[model samples]
Target: MQKIVILDYGMGNLHSVASALQKVAPGDEVVLATTPEQAEGADRLIVPGVGAIRDCMEGFIRPGFVPLLNRCIETGMPVLGICVGMQIMMARSEENNGVDCLDIFPQPVKFFGTDLKENGERLKVPHMGWNQVQQKIDHPMWRDIENGSRFYFVHSYYVPAENNDALAGETEYGVRIAAAVARENIFSTQFHPEKSADAGLQLLKNFVDWNGQY
Candidate 1:
């Protein structure tokens, strides 16, 4: 059975994400790893996070954690990042008075700003609830999932579509946001796939079956 390691740096919805992965890929071994050594030999790695970027970065500050992630990516092991998990992959986040991230993706995670309106209606700060994602490019992660499928989202900051050639999916909330991104062995989503119903389950399954390729 394949070994799927979900990095538990202490900031994500670990139980929920683990439950979802177990549900989707019953045959695989799903592990919650707190340290780099614990994550060794993982066939696939999942980085999941919730709450503010500052807290998430704190968890990531652990020694050898960042290097482990980089090794996974360099070796072509499939890596899936979720929500704030996705944001941390960027160069930096504008949250917590600005925080430097993994810099895997040379893009900045920006705040939605105070004023946001769609059709003249004031949009909420934490863009909660469901929103449709428009697939920008073809990839294995999109397998069997529809192009405009709605996914659960809850965030005040987003990765803007600027200098992001790895943009894989887009969703609009006031302005356009990079809902998903992919580069080589890595794929990440701004939306929560674990909470996104069947479509989300399908996405998890795709990651399980993905061979770290396009």
Candidate 2:
């Protein structure tokens, strides 16, 4: 049986992410993994987060999950990171006074401060609500999800990866944010698929079928 493990470092909405995965792939085992052994044994892995980047990084290192995560990526294990989980994959974040990150993407997460504006109007800092995701490159995870599909987003900071090829999707909120990023065996999203409606569900379904290929 295929097992999909959601790493539990006590910083994410674990139940909701698990529930969403179960709904999409009921036949597959969806389990929350609190230990490194459980996480490393999964057929697929998900790193979901909701909180400050500093706390998330601390949670990862506190439980000795950093090495396990690195091993998973090195072994070509299919992994997905959501929200702040995605941000920490970068080299560093400007949140909480410049915290160092995992350096998976060699990018930096930038905060959309209160001064951000669109057409002379100040945009909200937390860029919350539904926004359209413009597909930047063709990817298997984007299989059934159409271009310009709307997804739910709630974030104050965003990743602007240096490599454009790694950017799978982009969205606008006074600035173009890296909505989704993908490399071999790994895919990350700034938007919450669990919170998004139909489009979000479809993307999750695609992830279930993906085999870490482009």
Task: Tell me each candidate's TM-score.
Answer: 0.98, 0.97
Per lDDT, the best of the predicted structures is 1
- List, residue by residue over 6-28, the lDDT tens digit for candidate 1: 99988866999999999999999
What stretches of model 2 exceed 4 Å from their correct place? 161-163
Q: Weakest 10 consecutive residues, lDDT, candidate 2?
A: 159-168
lDDT score, candidate 2, position 69: 85
Q: Write down the lDDT of every candidate, Cα atoms only.
A: 0.93, 0.89
Best model number under TM-score: 1
Q: Write the per-residue lDDT of candidate 2 for residues 1-214, one digit (tens) a residue.
A: 6899888988967898889888999999988888887765588988899999989999988877888888888988889999988998988999999999999987789988879999999998888999999998889999888899999999999987345568989999988899999989999999999989888989888889989888
lDDT of 1 at 76: 98
